[model samples]
Target chain A: MRIIAFASGKGGVGKTTIVANLGIALARQGKKVLMVDTDLAMANLSLILGMETSPITLNDVLKGDAGVWDVVYDGPEKVSIMPASLGLQDTQRLDLTKLPGIIKQVAPKYDFVLLDCPAGIGEDTLAAMASSTEVFLVVNPHSLSIADALKTKIAAQRINAKPVGLIINMYAGLKGEIPERDIISMLELPLYGVVPYDEEVRKTFYYKKIQPVILRNPDAEASKAVYVVAGKILGIEIDIKKQGGGFFAWLKRLFSR
Target chain B: MGLFSKLAFKLLGIDDTELPAEQIGYIKDISKEYSVPEILKNTFGEFVDSLLHKHLIEGVVVFKENSLIYSSSPDILELANKLYEMFSSFKRENKVLYFNVGSWVSMFEKDEFVYMIKSDTRLCEFELNAVAKDIAVHGKNIFLEEYRKIMSFVKV
Candidate 1:
């Protein structure tokens, strides 16, 4: 399986959101995708996906009480999520011996393995990187953010992991001045695509239980942008019109088939 | 240089890349965890955290005996490739610069006057901002003469 992880040097840069959306985009392309919440500490991917109380979690798999499939949940767009429990936050750091074996067991089953890593560099973040093949850095267009990203690049090289590219999140077109060139210069990372700041991403978790923003607005700027990146990561050509559908429609078809 | 090579890429100017905030902080934090200099720790942490919060830093790592030991995220690999491209323009001109004057910040003692310079040369960076400053008292020759007159009570 091709494993890709979403990570940031600092917190609150929309790492989890990208993971949730990107996984759906890839899965919608007919690729069996598995989204792993390696951020054992602040296990919040579930909240982003709107499944706060999952039946099982990564802790169960780590503790040997359940298989990886048991903790896996269907995400908004049929993406499989290996969740982390709120109660097992401390287990964020992977136990080396069991990790390779566990990853080996499940890696062959999926086309894409996307890991939602926690914020900051700790034992947990490193372990997540170790399990993946490529890494996607998330950044905001700010000097301080660019500076941290500069340093984060060094950290990645310290370990022999491939730095894939970057995603600019919460992209604000202030007065039509995107500062795209400045950010590109400062962070010195490849510009994959920009995700415009959208209130719908936050609202979907509350009133509507949508699988992903793509299903709601396939043509939305942010959704389209995310799909482009997902397409690049999975190396697949995507036609959004072919994949746009609500959750119930998918459920009905699943039951019928 | 072996230790430097292991970390050369992680630090600013150590390789042909722009150091991400997370990687910078991770290196500093890890270095400090093993008794690295306090100056690097303080400045690096502040700089890295600030960038990270702003989303400038995408990935970071803390190495243990080389290899991809630990990281802020698995995506650090992607950040590295981008950084390689990001700093390529400045790579040829990168250099290790030193300051002759004492630091402008007053938090450090007057006797602790020391030059602040960029240690990383992988990227061509020539600017250094004054992080902090403090005021100090100065006296002229006339003031010294007046002070001597005022010291009449002394056994002259």
Candidate 2:
């Protein structure tokens, strides 16, 4: 199995959302994907998947109270998930070192293993990176987020993890936003894909009906972008048609105007 | 006053007649448990809790030896244990571990024991690093004083 970890130097960069949607997208492409919520302390993947409480979580597996296989829940879009415990007290007693072994045990069963890591370069994040074969750094198109992504890249290098590339999210074409080329130059990582800012994504969180954008609204610009990223990862070509009308259609509208 | 008013007073620079009694009581409870100074407890707890609540830093845990002294949230003891091991190894190598991810900064000091400070948002890396250095330089005295206070009340 190809183990890939999605991590961000900073928080609120939509790392978990990417993992959730990308997992679904890959599943749609006939790839068996397992999305593991490795962000133990702030376990939100389960919530994002609309399974706020699971009887068995990664916490149980780490504590030896339950096996990893026992905690695998059937998430939306046929993607398997090993959710983390939501309880605050449960975060304290985890053995993060058990992650690699758990991944090792489950890696052979799936085509892709996507670890949704917590923000920052903390031990939990490092452990997730250490266990994964490749790391994908997620960042927003902002100086602070880009700077943090650079640090995260360095930290990943320190542990000898291969950083696959960068996935720029929340691209709104704002006036002061950093350019994609500059981020690539500074971080020295190839651009995997860019997910545009979409209100549908915000509504997903606001309404608490956490479903993958790809499955919820495939026509959305953000959803199309996510599909492209998933396609790139799987070495498949996803044809996303441009939205605007062709030359003849444009001419007709102009004449009408 | 309510918690929101207190938060507004502190975060939004709003004026209030008095601090929130519930918040103050919560800080006092933490101060009693950790045996740290009330002022320090109140300030650090509020800062850390605000970050966690905002999802800035995933979690923060402080422990001496095997005992957890403080944590920003619950269910993160394993993270603390792993950090302790990693920092302990770094300490053995006569090195400190520091890294900045996004806006978050984490620093580990291996003096008498391992002390870790982690946070993101409202503080840049330079400022957070300065605070970490200060803690490394002078934290032992404060921690020892708190430990002494706690030991005095021990039944054994």
Candidate 3:
């Protein structure tokens, strides 16, 4: 089984969203996927998946109260999930050293295991990366974001973690944003895929009806981009027809006229 | 008076009879080679003097390559060595460790280097770990910049 950790240097970069959607996308391709929320301190994967309450969580496993199998919840699209507890006290008593053993126990049951790591290179983030077979860095197009991602790459390299590639999220092609090509060059990592900034993504989070955009709106520009990423991960070429004549495209045509 | 006698009489206000021959011989032997003790004293003395001048630290000790290189207070060397050993073991286990004793907060980096910053100002363990993370991630030059920025805020 291949285990990949989705990590970012800064928060609010859509790391969790990418992991959720990517898991669903991979599951849709007939791959058994396991999505794990390894961000123990601020566990939001459950909230993002509209799973506010779970009978068992990673906290119980870390605290020696429950087994790993007890916390595994069947999420959408045949993706198994292990969500972490939201207790502040649990963060303090967590034994991060046990994370690798925990992942090892369950990794054999799935084709792909995606770990949603916390922001920044803390001990928890290192533990999660150490447990994974490869790491995928998520970053925005801002210079600070790129700088922090470079630091994350360096940290991962120091720990001998294999960095698979870079995922550019929330790309809007806006002014003052760093270009994707430059980000790839500066980070010195291959571009897996770029997910565009879309209004539908905000609506999903705002409404707390967290579902993969690929399944929700397959025609969305962002959804198509995510499918490309998932296809690359699965080593499958999906025939995605380019859909044009959106409002932005129409506005560009009007301006050009 | 002769040159040696004159120098001794002027510096010590004592004749050659008062200065033992062994003591004079020992001084001559020390002057022939570069004195490591003197150099360590002068270098560390200057460092302590500057910190005192700036009122940055009450005492400090430094270790590199598993040896005590410089120290403002000799009494702290034993404790520093112990802490170094502890941090070394932690590094072997792939863990970063930090702690505080009284007014001084100590940070142990992955390169087997330790820094003691004297301040009553409290910083959470997360912030301390973040400092260690930056050093591990960005290398020494960038870590030094971050160290300087932290010192700028904490230095009185």
Candidate 4:
């Protein structure tokens, strides 16, 4: 299983939105994706997916009341989430020595496990990096955002976490010509994907947008971009507008039939 | 004196910028070296004479196991002398000096304080937290590569 972690240097930079979208995108491609809400204190991924109260959460699993099968819930777009409770301090104080065993128990069941990590270089982030194989350093195009990201990269290096690439979320339009080149050069990390700051993404949950754009509006420019990224992750070329011919085509037709 | 100075300078690489003109000439004359700069010779001669009679810094013998433990600070000299007396009374082998580096220097032997010197910035690590505390306490060595140059002036 490919364990990819989504992390940001500072909070409120759409880390959850990226995880949610990536989970759906992967699932649409017939990949069994598991989205983990590891933000223990202020868990918000459930709210984003419009799930008021999951029958089981990460707290229950950590407390051993429920297994991974019991806690995983279907999200908006067929993606599954191992939910977490808000204001969970006891679980947050869990002994770090036992985290790897817990991950190993639940990791092998899915094709992709994406962890939504907390902000800052605290123990929680360190634990997440320890459990993850590849780290996605999420950032916006602002100057201070890039500066904070550099500090985050140093912290990641301290634990020897392999950085797969940088995800430039919230791509605001060309106003004064963004300094994208300078940031890429100074950071020395590859640009994985540039998710445009669109209203569809912000309104995805509220408006009941469950299907991946790669499945719905395959001809749209943003959908095409996301499909290309999804294809790269799956090690195959996918034409977003091809309608129904790819690795997941048989499953798509199985559902459509 | 001149031969000793050359040997010391050669071994330590003490540059001309760290020495006065008069001391340079005196050192040159004692070693039968005619290359003494005139001004440096005058300064060295005057400094030595003051050391002999003025009791300015005379009693300070900065040794490892001597009854007399001396320091060069004018402000904290009284407290230092009291501590020295306390140590000397017990026959303890120790002395201490306060440096501009804003740190306390304690020595069991004279050699410890004899080598205390400042560092330059260009040679040391760029990050402030990575720098050695005593070397960076003065805040001048932030420039880099200068700590190595100042090492030559230390009386090893």
Q: Across residues B75-139, which tens digit of lDDT does each residue of candidate 3 receive?
A: 67666777778766665343435556666546444455554433354433333343344334434
Write candidate 4's Cα lDDT for A10-81 as tens digits. Answer: 888778867766676778778888888877667878776667777667776666666757878887657778
Task: Please write out the lDDT profile of model 3 over residues A95-150, one tens digit for every residue.
Answer: 77788899999999999999999999887888888889999999987766776777
Q: Please report the candidate that would top DockQ against the real structure.
A: 2
lDDT tens digits, residue span A14-123, model 2 = 99989998898888778899999999989989888878679888988998889879999898868899998888888877777678789989989999999999999887
Model 2: residue A225 alpha-carbon error in angstroms: 0.1
Off by over 4 Å in 2: A241-257, B1-156
Model 1 C-alpha lDDT per residue in residues A55-170, reported as the tens digit of each score: 77887677676786677777776777788887745464444335445666778989998888887765566567656788878887655555555555545443434567888888
Question: B123 in model 4: Cα distance from truth in Å?
Answer: 30
Worst 10 residues of 2 chain A by lDDT: A241-250
Error of 2 at B124 (Å): 24
| lDDT against the true structure, each candidate | 0.57, 0.71, 0.71, 0.56
DockQ scores for all predicted structures: 0.02, 0.02, 0.01, 0.01
Best by lDDT: 2
Per-residue accuracy of model 1 over B1-156 as CA lDDT, tens digit each: 477786865674333433245644453454334321111223434433433332222333322111222233454444433433433333333122222222211111112121121122221111111111110111123223433454553547
TM-score of the A chain in candidate 4: the value is 0.82
